[model samples]
Target: MSKEQVVVARKKKKKVKIFPIVNVILFLVISLIIMVPIWKVIVDSFDAKAGYGMNFLPQTFTLGGYSSILSRVALYRPFLISVVVTIAGTFIGLLLATLGAYVLIQWEMPGRNFFAYMLLFTMIFDGGMIPKYLVMKDLHLLNTLWSVILPLSINVYNLVLMRNFFEGVPESLFEAAEIDGCSPMGTFFKIVLPLSKAALASIGLMYAVQFWNDYTNFKIYINKNELFNFQMKLRNMVMDNDIPDEGGIDPNTIANAAVIVAILPFAIIYPFCQKYFVQGVNVGAVKE
Candidate 1:
């Protein structure tokens, strides 16, 4: 090659290398921007002397903040409520998503297209908040845990994701099941569900997170304080200065500690679910 061509080739190689380097630096900077505040919160949660200022490490490391929040009898009801709501909501959501997705995949089922369209319509629109509230009242569901659980349980996005995953199941499996004299429900239980562990874990985690983090529904629908979930109680603690007195622990410390406690479940659970979560999302998202 000519000297000029050789120089151009080297420059091109240098440019290619520079792009990846720039991308690495860009992502690192973005990661720091996101993680810095989270790290600060974590630090403050442990810091008995936690204040409003930025802190990378706790000046006075202590678990008193956590102890105070946990020991408070007032928090117990809300914590239990949150656990019940999360478990029940996740179960119902998964049941609806899986069953509805299965039915949508039955090519011979009458009104399948119409049903799918109706569900899709809901994704585009809904009755406004007041009307929904009125409906809940009419159903005599207000001020109950069901008021919180039922409203958020029917997520159309999750339904669509599950349907997509179900569609990805090989047709041959169904044919084989049919040849073996298996009923539709039997095939679903034996074949479809067995093959859908990843999707279930992925979608279940989504439901659990949504239900766990929910506060607005609880705030709006539940009038009884005893029925309020952890998120609701946490909001009260953080926003309304309602932290329970635990020997005059700094309110900031308790609030930060509560924040950590709130997120801790997912922090521990996500690592275990991550492999299945990634696979499920990928399979549900991609198509031939």
Candidate 2:
């Protein structure tokens, strides 16, 4: 290369003078703070033989805590219920929210603003729990999987985010699709959705997290232990004072183990959705 070109390349390769030692020290301190509790719980799950003691690391390690909960009827069933409900609820909620948001943006539609207001209104106001229960009872949606899926089938805040996302899409894209003799549904599926994947991805993560963490509706509307969700069961493990009737495992171990299991899936799912969210928002691909 020529001398001028070499100098230019060197100028472009500018480096910052960050202190590597200080950064490493800070990182280690933060990592220890986060990992300590997680490590403690994992150790506690193996602490069945410790015989009533508390410490950061287990003095007596056994898998009894994990085994006992896994073997229980109420416990495992709830885990399954939570998984099924989260998946079903997330998908259905996404479909309804996306479709509704898209249609509300159609200027030609009658009562579009009124419907938008209605949806927005739900974000700020809600009927009391008792009234909601009565309505659910009247609808005969109580105690079924539908009970979990139906009441929270839509969220107004999410609808707004989706509407904003769809509106951010370009008018020319929609116009081009129309010019090509595409129907509304076809244009939406081919052009709008393909470009709006980031918004869809972000909304999907939000819905999944909300549904996965919720147990209140189930507690109020459901009477059967068989229908308990992962969160409700975790609540029991932490709050319920009852020891095992057979007396093999203690309450603390069960509580900690349940806490760990209940949270582990989210720890896995969020980073995945997060990566897509950052990508989608930055590219403006989801915007109209």
Candidate 3:
């Protein structure tokens, strides 16, 4: 090769390395941005020595903090409540969303366009918090589990995404099933749902996250302490500032531990769901 060609090739290689280095640095920075706070929370949650706030890292580690929250007085009753709500809500939400999406897209029902528009409209405009509260109150759903699950049974965005997923199933498969002994219900179970598993897995994870993090609905709709969701309880532990000093544990410990607990479960579960999550979320984003 000519000397000029060799120099140009070296320069291009160097340029490529530089771009990759920059990208790596950017990713590291963003990771730290996410990791730093989480590390602080986990550390502070156990840092009985650091007092109110964490500094860099904990000087001491103690299970005392975690133990206190689940101790006799605390026992994390709210966490149990949250767990039930989250499980029920996630399953119910996924079921309704899947069925609603399937019916919306595959069926030749009356006023199909109107129903779709109504759902689409919900995504754009809400009945506002006051009206929603009033409706729930009138329906006698306040302070009940239904208050959390019913109002958001079918997330409009999730429904649309799922509908897109259902539509992506091969029409030929449905036709073939129909030609056999399969009815529409049989076709859905035999053909549509099997192909739509990834979408459902992904949406189920999304609903799980929503259930875990939801507070506004719980706050407005459920007033009972027995019914408090994890986020709501964690909010109280952190924001209330006057936690009345449970047993021997200090205020800092309660706040730190609660916040850490609130965040930890999602961190553990999200990666498992990411495979389908990325696929499900992206499938609806582009036109075929």
Q: All models: lDDT?
A: 0.90, 0.79, 0.79
Using Cα atoms with residue i matched to residue i, what is each candidate's TM-score against the true structure?
0.93, 0.78, 0.85
Tens-digit per-residue lDDT, 1-288, candidate 1: 999999999998887567889999999999999999899889998887789999888998888889988898988999999999999999999999999999999999999999999999999998889999999999999989899899888998999999999999888899999999999999999999988999999999999999999988988899887888998888877898887666646778999999999999999999999999999988654343
Off by over 4 Å in 1: 1-12, 17-19, 245-248, 284-288
- How many pairs of residues collide in model 2? 6
lDDT of 1: 0.90
Instruction: Give the candidate order by descending lDDT.
Output: 1, 2, 3
Model 3 bad stretches (over 4 Å): 1-22, 52-54, 73-75, 107-110, 242-250, 284-288
Worst 10 residues of 3 by lDDT: 242-251
- lDDT by residue for model 3 over 1-288, one digit each (tens)? 999999999998887557889999999999999988877777777776647554776676666777666662553787888888889998899888888888887567998889999989988888899998899889998889899987767698888888988877777787889889799888878777887767888888888888878898988888788888767876776686745564555567667786776778988888888887888776554233
* Candidate number with greatest TM-score: 1
What does candidate 2's lDDT look like per residue over 1-288, in tens digits? 999999988887886547997899999999999987787777777676434444766776666666666677767778888889999999999899889988987989999999999877877888888898898899998889888787777788777878877887898898999999999999889987887788888888878888898888888888987788988877876677544632655567766666777888988877878877776555434433
lDDT of 1 at 10: 91
TM-score of 3: 0.85
